[model samples]
Target: SAGRPMTAINSSYYAATAYRSDRMPNQPPSAERSWIRRFAKFRLPWGLTQEVALDDFLIRRKPSSLRFQEEMNKEREEKQKLGTYIPAPYEHVNFHDRHDHESFRFSLWSKRSHFWIYLTGGGRGLFYIAFVVSMMTYFLMLFALDDPWLTTTVELLPILATWIFLPLFCWALGALVIRYLPHLWVKPSRGPIWEINRRTGLVTLFDYDNNGEYKKNGTIGELTAPFYEFDAYIATIPDRQGLVTNVLYIAHRYRDIVINFRPLFAPGEGQLCCALWDFLQNYMDTSRPLPDLPRYEQYRHLDPTTAEYDRKTRRNPRFWIDMNDATFEQELYAMRGKIDQIDTFQRPNLMARHVEYVD
Candidate 1:
């Protein structure tokens, strides 16, 4: 009875159970049958000769059914022997969740410490330069005077005064400016340098918007802008070993403070500049084990006598300043020249990369 087709049954149970009461409603055709009819127009050849009932098709009485059962049993036995079915290939462990917190803490400490060191170095450099120039000027004055007593007196007084008083005055002034000038302290016009975390990669410039506060022109009846805001990235970079390398400096000119003077060196500019100065101090201290990946390494092994590698190998990695416009080109050039002279002893390469005028 289990193997018999229900189409031949006469009982009410059979009628009630029919797929469609009017036309075998309770029993629908299998997907295989539907697929065969749908693509029958293609005239594809069939491997089996006869249409078989579902019950008989799955039983071992039929040759195809017996073969299918044997294959299935073999597969079952193999899987059982293997303990459990496992798909090919294994998953990799995600290390981010495990080490993220530690990495973040270390990065934060490094950035803070580095920034402090950088500021100290910059401040010392500034003081040293001022001292050197003052001393040089004093000597020149002595030579020009051609009077032994006056020259000696003038030289000694300024040297003693500078050594004892000038540094204190400058330090006090710097502290006062940093504290009282909150607006100027964080302002973008100060050539604000920013350092993003070491893991984030390069910081990119975003939109710049100008604040409405402006100075007015008397005759032209025009309003002068007072502040500019830039939306920029705070990003970090990684080293070859997947470790945080250094923070990146990103400049975004979101807004401009248009004043009577050239917008470039206006008062608001101090904020940006100071911010940059602050950031540079931090960056120099934090960024370490400078990326020394050999440039043009691919061509190094091509020939024993390749001139490109030979030249590059002898030269050290260089750092260059990139400027936006020609307006600041002269200032940046002078700074680069000064840096070159200072770094002459170390022989570290320094240069500038200037961008073209945009508007």
Candidate 2:
């Protein structure tokens, strides 16, 4: 069912939550754990899909909901005064979710239009299951033809060809649909840079070239627009049988941004995706008005982590403020300094594969 149509879970989940910071302050840690449970009870957010439910939860928890809204207000005001959407060259958004004194294990970033969402967990299970089903279907087709197993090369040729070409066509069609359905449809695929510019009232995307320059500096293959256009949607990329593997980002243009939210369809993926959306929607207040920079400025507070992170990275304060192509390269070089190695994390508890050949 991955190849099925993009089930509309929320026609405007991201858009609707943009300015609703008032409700975000009082939520406790336990509230996040039970959000899915609560949603199931109410069937809320409308257009519920299994994928959306999982992702929305994770995304919502990544940034301190309190801090995220606070920063959103700051950036919104800054954009209004400048009349441009350029990011604060020095502003760094860092979060360290730590316990037992291990310090921050994750380095998820989102400041103004910049974001580094952790979308690397879950989805392989569904894909492996889908692969198994494809194999099962192939065998069934062969058996229905009254064909013996590997009995003759001549007869086997047609069966093998059919098995191969059929899935190939399905995969191709799925890719085509995901790639070309532009202007308020799915984005082309996922890359590095993402931005929702309140200043210009547009969402911009940049290709992830290895330049290591400031996140994005007028790069090639740019995708930008107010994606609330007709035909803009959130759809999935499918395997041969059209089961969802990734949710392609769709807006006014086919931004090549496909999120692999269904690698095995683990519940964890949905969480990460949801968290990403939460960070993104902060910048995507479509009805946001200009001005009020002073109001946002007042909310800015001195963060304790700033000094510690600076020392950890061993960089100067002004170094970040004067970000450019060359400085980005230098910072990457500095990060290569050796650190203690962590234990290898095992993943993939199960797999799907064809029968192994015997000697």
Poorly placed runs, candidate 1 (over 4 Å): 1-122, 149-152, 159-164, 168-359
lDDT of 2 at 133: 67
User: Which lDDT tens digits does candidate 2 get at residues 1-359?
Assistant: 00122122232323332322222222211112133322322110111112112222223332334355668878988987989766643344233221111011122233311211111111233344555665776667667766566654455556556655555555554445434532223222333344444333344445455364435673446555442220112233355775554332333312333222233234322233332232233323222211111112222122122223334456444333234546544443432221111111121101011111110
- The list of candidate 2 runs beyond 4 A from truth reads 1-191, 208-221, 229-231, 234-248, 251-283, 286-359
**Tens-digit lDDT track for model 1 on 144-249?**
7768967577657766566645555555555555556433332222111122222222222211222322223222122221111111122233446676432212
Cα error of candidate 2 at position 187, Å: 27
Clashes of 2: 32
Give per-residue lDDT, candidate 2, residue 108: 24
lDDT of 1: 0.30
Error of 1 at 58 (Å): 66
Which candidate number has the best TM-score?
2
Q: How many residue pairs clash in each candidate?
A: 39, 32
